[model samples]
Target: MLVTGVKIQGRADEAQWVTQFKVQYSNDGNSWTFVQHTNNQSDMIFDGNTDRSTISTNIFPAQVTAAYIRLVPTAWHIHISMRFEILGCKECKTPLGMKNRDIPATRIKVSSRGEYYIINSNDNTSTHHKGGSHARLDRFHYWVPDNDDINPWVQVYVGLGKIVSGIIIQGFKQHWTRHDFIKVQVNGSIFESINANLESTWTHDHPASHATLMFEKPVVTSVVRVEPNDCSETTRKLTNGNQIVILDCALRMELLGCGNIPEHGCVKPLGMETGDIQGTQIRVSYNHHQSNESRLNYRGYWGGSSPNINRWIMVYFGYVVNISGIVIQGYEVYWVELFVIEEMNNPTIGTQEYAANFDGYTPVTVLFEKLVHTTYIKVTPTACHNGYCGVRMEILGICDDNSNP
Candidate 1:
C-alpha cells in the first residue's frame, strides 16, 4: 500500500491523551525508516489531540510504500494511550512496460549463453534471431531461436535503478510446452527459477496458457534475464511415417512493477533545460534581488532580495510525481554551498527536509535515499558562497506519475 496519512484518537480520559509522536514504516516489517524533520537528522514529531474525543490527523511528508507501519510516542498528556488508523489508497501492480512498447525494443537483448545450444547466436555460426523484443505476452508472438539453438535466452534492460516484483510468461498458442526449466536473473544473480507449465491447449485465435512468477522480495536492478536450465521438448508423428520434435522453451513474457518505469528507463532530467516546465511552475520565497522571474534554468539564478535564513526556491509540479534525485548547478561564482530539500504534501505538514552539500559551478547530482512522491519540492539554502546564494536546477526523475492505477 502507498501510505499517505495517519489518524490518531486519544484515550477516553483527557489526562491520558497522547501529545506528540513519531511514525515509522517498513516494507518487510524487519527493517524500518522513519519520516524525518526539516533538520534531516531526527524523526518528525507530530502533534496529537488536546481533548480526548478529538482526533489528530497528520499527513506524511511524501507518500511511503510499505506493508507495515508503527507509531512511537514521544510525549503525552499523562500517559501514552491512543487509537489510530493508517490512511492511503490501494496500489495496483501494472505491467512494467514490457508487453506494450513502453520499454523500447533496443533495450531487450537476446543470446545463446548456456551450453545447451550447438548454434551460438554471437559466434556468427548461424543467423541470429531477436527473442526478447518478440516476447510480448498474448500478441501471437513467441521467441523461438534458430534450429539447434538449444540455449535461447532473453535479457531486458529495465534501467539502472528500478524495482521489479514479478513477471508473467506465456507459451505459443499452437504448442504445448513446459517452461519449468526457465529462471529469472536480476543483475546477474539467480533469484529464482520459473516452475510454470507453459502448455497451451487453445487454438491460434484463443489465449494461450501462461504462468505468473512472483518474487519473495522486490528486486532493484538494471537488468532482468529469463533463461532455461535444461532442454525440454515434445515429439510428434507426421502423416508420412516420420517423427518431428519441438522445443518447449518458446515463450512470451511481461514484467510487473510500479513507479515511473514505463516513461523512462532510469533517472533523467525532468524538463528544466528542455522547457517542459513553465515559469508558472516555479516560485521563490524572498527574491528581493528581483532576479529573473524564471530562475529554474541556467538562463537565470534565483537569489533572495535580502540576506535571510528562510530563503527558499520551490517547484510546484501541479500533480503528484515520483522523483529520485535533483541536479544542482550554480551561476558563475555565486552558488549555494549547503542546502536541504523538502517534499511537501501540505502547506503546514511535511516540513521535513533532506540535506545536501556541493561546491562550485559544476553541476552536482544529489540522490535521495529512496524515491519520493509528492506534488511540491522546496529547496532552502543553508550556506552560500560570500553570503550570496543562487540556484539553477533540474529534477532527476521519471516523467509520469505512478501513484495512480
Candidate 2:
C-alpha cells in the first residue's frame, strides 16, 4: 500500500498539534504492527510546519500489504482530526494510486555494452510490472547487469516527457551482493544518489529487500536512467563463472505527469482530413506538444470569429479508452478561452465544458471527476483569450486493454 498524503484538520492551537505518531497496520483488524522504514525504527515525527489550522503532508512509500492501517498519536497537545491516504490498492481503506501512465509496450532501450547474464532479452522491453510481487526471485524476469562491467546502466524512453517521482528496485534474495552505490538521471541530469549501506547505518537497521529511491521533488523528463556502481572490487561476488552483481533485479518506476492524448497513427487536423479550411496557419501534428518544449511556431489552430466563434478538431483513439484528464499548453500570447469536450459513443455525447480564462504561456490541467471510456474525443473552442487561438494538448488515459495498440 502506498501512503500518498495526509490531511489534518481542527484547531490551530498548540494544544491540539500532533508532534509524533506511529503508522501501524493489521491483517485482521486486531493485532497491529508498526511499519518500519529503512532501518527498524518505528517513530515518525511531523516534518516542517506543524502549527496550522490545516496540515497537508506529502509522503510516498513503497507498496505495502495489510488489511487495516491507522495512525496512533504518540504526542499531541489536544484532540484533532487526522486522515491518511493509502494509494495503489483497491481493497485497502484509501484510494488507488494513479496507474502507470506510460503507454504499454513503449520501447525501453538499454546500453548495448552492459552484460545481461541471467535475464531474458525480452524482459526489459515492457513498461508494466507485476504490482506487489517483490518476492519473485527468477532472474529471467529481471534486468541484471554483469558484475565485471564498470558502469552498468538501464534507460527507459517513455515515448514522451512525463513527471517522475520515485523508482523501486527489487534486489536478488539468493546469493547476490547488493548494489552498494546507485545513481538516477532524468533527461541526462542527475536526480538523486543512494548509498544503501550508509543509509542503513544511519537508520540503525538493515536495508530493505527492495530499494526505493524517491526524489525530494518530482521531475519532468522523457528519459530515465539507473546506474549501478561497484564502489569496491573486494565486495563478495556471485559465482557461476561470472561474478554475481545483481542476480535477479526488477524495477517498478512511478510517473506523475500526463502523456499524449491522440493516437499518432490517427491524428489529423480538422482541415487536413476534410480539406475544409485549407489555408489556415495552424495544423495538428502528434509530436509537436508531446514534450515540454514551448515552440512559438509549432501549434494547432481552432479558428473562428468574434465572441461566439466555434472551432473544433476531432481525434480517434482506434479503440475505447479510460480517460482521466487532459493537459493543455498554449502559445505565448494566444490561448483557448471557452471550450467543451465530447466523446463518441452511440450518438456522440458531451462530457465536460470549461469557461475559465487561463494565461496563454502557462500549462493548465483539467482532471475528470472519474475515468470515462470513449473511442473518440472532440475538442471545441468557443472563445479566445486574446483574439488569437492555438494550443498544444495531451489526453491522459489508458486503454481498456491497458496496452499500446
The number of clashing residue pairs in each candidate reads: 2, 6
* Model 1 bad stretches (over 4 Å): 2-68, 73-89, 112-130, 145-152, 158-163, 173-180, 187-207, 219-223, 233-246, 259-405
TM-score for each candidate, following the candidate numbering: 0.42, 0.31
Please provide, for model 2 over 123-174, each residue's C-alpha lDDT reduced to its tens digit, 9 standing for 90 to 100. Answer: 3321223222221222233444444545656555443324455554444323
Report the C-alpha lDDT of model 1 over 23-84, residue by residue, as the tens digit. Answer: 99898999998877523667788777686776565656445678899999988877789988
lDDT of each: 0.62, 0.43
* Backbone-clash count (model 2): 6
- Top TM-score prediction, candidate number: 1
CA lDDT, candidate 2, residue 37: 49
Which window of 10 residues has the lowest lDDT sum in candidate 1?
Answer: 113-122
The predictions' CA RMSDs to the true structure, in order, are 12.6, 16.9
Question: TM-score for model 1?
Answer: 0.42
